[model samples]
Target: MLRARRWSTRLFNLQRQGRMGTTAPIDGEEAAVVGSAAAMDPAVDWAVPQYREPVGLSRFGDRVLLHTILYHLGHPDAGAYPPDIHVFPTQISIAAQIPHAVGLAWGLRLRGEPGAVLCYFGDGATSEGDFYEAANLAGVVRAPVILLCVNNSWAISTPVRLQTAAGSIADKAAAAGIPGVRVDGNDVVAVREATAAARRRALAGEGPTLIEAVTYRMGPHTTADDPTRYVPPEELAAWAERDPIARLGTRLEQAGLWDDDRQRAAEEDADRRFDAAFDAAQATPLRDDVFIDTAYASPTPQLERQRRLLHDERSRGAG
Candidate 1:
């Protein structure tokens, strides 16, 4: 998982260099994101991420090149519910994907599929109506889902203080009559254990669990953001002391799982892999957008006309 953080740093640099489009930086929340994902079984668990979960997706698909393509293009079809995976396409809306994740868990329970769903969202998403509705329904139906909210201090530019008066986001689970847990988001072991426990409860038909990971966003919200404008320099410096990688590195060193030599080799390998993947993503041919095939069944006349217009627009752009 620390390796993933390293790769994301390079990816962020690429985005900064204008080799990519929009990106949501996941620098400080790597443990919260990757640790939770590492606990999920890709074969049966499902993840609905809100634009900032590439590290989690890496747990499911180690195909760095494919993920590179997905991130670089940011195409609609790229996230159109790809087949047979634990993760879905990156969500764009604030909290809209929460309901979809609840329904997925509910449907899986209805079909007796024994599959659980994991949903990721930021602190700001909690203020949205969709979040409450989805939480209520998931609790009522005992949906097998784990709602992992990464409360990374700030939601874009809005800080958590302005978003909710509650002491902790995890406490919100009580309104739905489910378990809520607060963990040190920087502690990878703690996050993993919490997720594993939640997964077990879900599989046992114990309903959903809401987890609030208390972490800080050590960097800008995204490539488009300028943290220096709003975030305090001292605040960033304070969180720097709680760096998840550094914390995890100490643990690994004690366990003999890591050393300076191993760390150096890992960093070099990650850079090499990312460079290759970036080049491959650039070289791979992109098929023209086909809006007509988006609809599963028959399209109405108006829909067909719209699709034609979109296709024409894309064709013109390509030409």
Candidate 2:
């Protein structure tokens, strides 16, 4: 969690410095992401995450971070993950990954693969039709999937009250004929246990589980958002008292398992790792015909002509 937080902070800083594109900060919801990811056996289980999660998904693979950096760098290869990674590329379309997760899990079952799919999305995604369709299908097919909905109180400028009238996001799981669990997202242990139970159910062929992790977004929804306009100052302050990283650090300190020196070391290591990845991403060559190359299996005559035209224009400009 410490490393994840530091990486997130560094990414945000990069965006501010105009070194990267728009990025989401995993500020207050670290536990909800890292804890749930920790419960999965990366060797077997797969992760499908929305855009905000790559930082916390180090539990799955370090390649996730490298790929994310490449993605922000506008590298075409960012869309591809190595065959063994067991993680899908980051989804920016709201709630779209939910159905993809369900499909992957169902396909795994059909192929007799022994693994479940862990899908992560935010509360804003719940409003999308994709969430409902995917959840219902998962129930009907008994897909080995876990739908983790991180309810961080606000969706962009929209608050929870405006997002839904249901008592809680977890309650929505009932329509899908699955168990709904609401866990204190600030507590890492509780989040881990909830996800573990959900994973057990999934692997046992019981079905999918919908987990609502109640937490707060202490920062803007993204680098482009201004939460101060909608998120009350007092509300942010109150949630600050329950910061997931600090809460876990305090518990670990009491157990004699953590200290300031260890925390500093973790932060420093994270900085070094991110810097190296950033440099690697920068060094990667950008493909000039990436659009034509990735858009089709074989380019049509019209596309071929356009590609040549583009190259000719570039060549003339260079000369």
Candidate 3:
């Protein structure tokens, strides 16, 4: 938890300093991420995470890759690594990765592989059509996928209460003929147990499971957002009482698993690592034509004209 807090602070600071393009701070959702990822076997599991899942991605040994991506959001790729090196590129569009996760799980199952795909998303994504379609397809195909919904109570400025009339996001899984569990997202132990159970069910061929981790997003949706405009100060203070990192740190300390010294060391380590990664990312060469292939193969006439103009300018400069 302390580690997560430190990284969150660093990431937020990077965003503020214009080092990172945009980032969703996970200050209050660390427990949900750490707990869920802690239950998985990294070698046999795949995690498809959204932008807000920093803690989850870190647990999967992608810390360096994460720092690299966070440092330069516009980089063409994640430093020549595989998708799951740390976490997959964070999905900006809502619920678009759901079907991809389900398809991967289905493929693995067909190959008789004993692995599960844990796809993380926010409560807002539940309202998207792909959410239902993916869940239904996973159920029908008995895909080894775990739909982990970090219901952080708000999607940008919209509260979960206003986003859905459903009693809970977990309840939606029942319609897909899969077991659904709602766990306290602030409680690391509860999240760990719930994730473990879900993985077990998937391995047993019981089909996919939906886990709705009811938590809060303590920070603004992003550096660009002014959450104060929508969220009341009192509510923010209330959520602060349930801060996931603090609560878990307290628990670990009580159990003789953590201490102030260890906490300090972890913070220092994270800071050092972040500094090194920031330097490395800044030192990396930037391709002059990196944005040239961002669009489809058949460029629009306007784009072609712009390309020709750039070429002409380069040729004249060479002359």
lDDT of all the models against the reference?
0.82, 0.92, 0.81
Clash count of each predicted structure: 0, 0, 1
lDDT of 2 by residue, 1-319 (tens): 8888888888888899998888888899999999999999999999999988888988888888888888776678886888878889889999999999999999999999999999999999998999999999999999999999999998899998998899999999999999999999999999999999999999999999999999999999898998878888999999999999999999999999999999988888999999888888888887778889777888888999999999999999999
Ranking by lDDT: 2, 1, 3
- TM-score per model over all chains: 0.91, 0.97, 0.89
The count of residue-pair clashes in candidate 1 stands at: 0
Worst 10 residues of 3 by lDDT: 63-72
Model 2 scores what on Cα lDDT? Answer: 0.92
Q: Candidate 2: which stretches are off by over 4 Å?
A: 316-319
Model 2 poorest ten-residue lDDT run: 70-79
In candidate 2, residue 4 scores what lDDT? 83
**Per-residue lDDT of 67-120 in model 3, one digit per residue for the tens?**
445444666644344554534556778999899899988998899888888899
What's the TM for model 1?
Answer: 0.91
* Candidates 1 and 2 compared by lDDT, better number: 2
What is the per-residue lDDT of model 1 for residues 63-163, given as tens digits with 9 covering 90 to 100?
63356445655644456445665676777899999999999999999998978888999999999999999999999999999999999999877889999
Question: In model 3, which regions exceed 4 Å deviation?
Answer: 63-72, 83-86, 291-310, 317-319
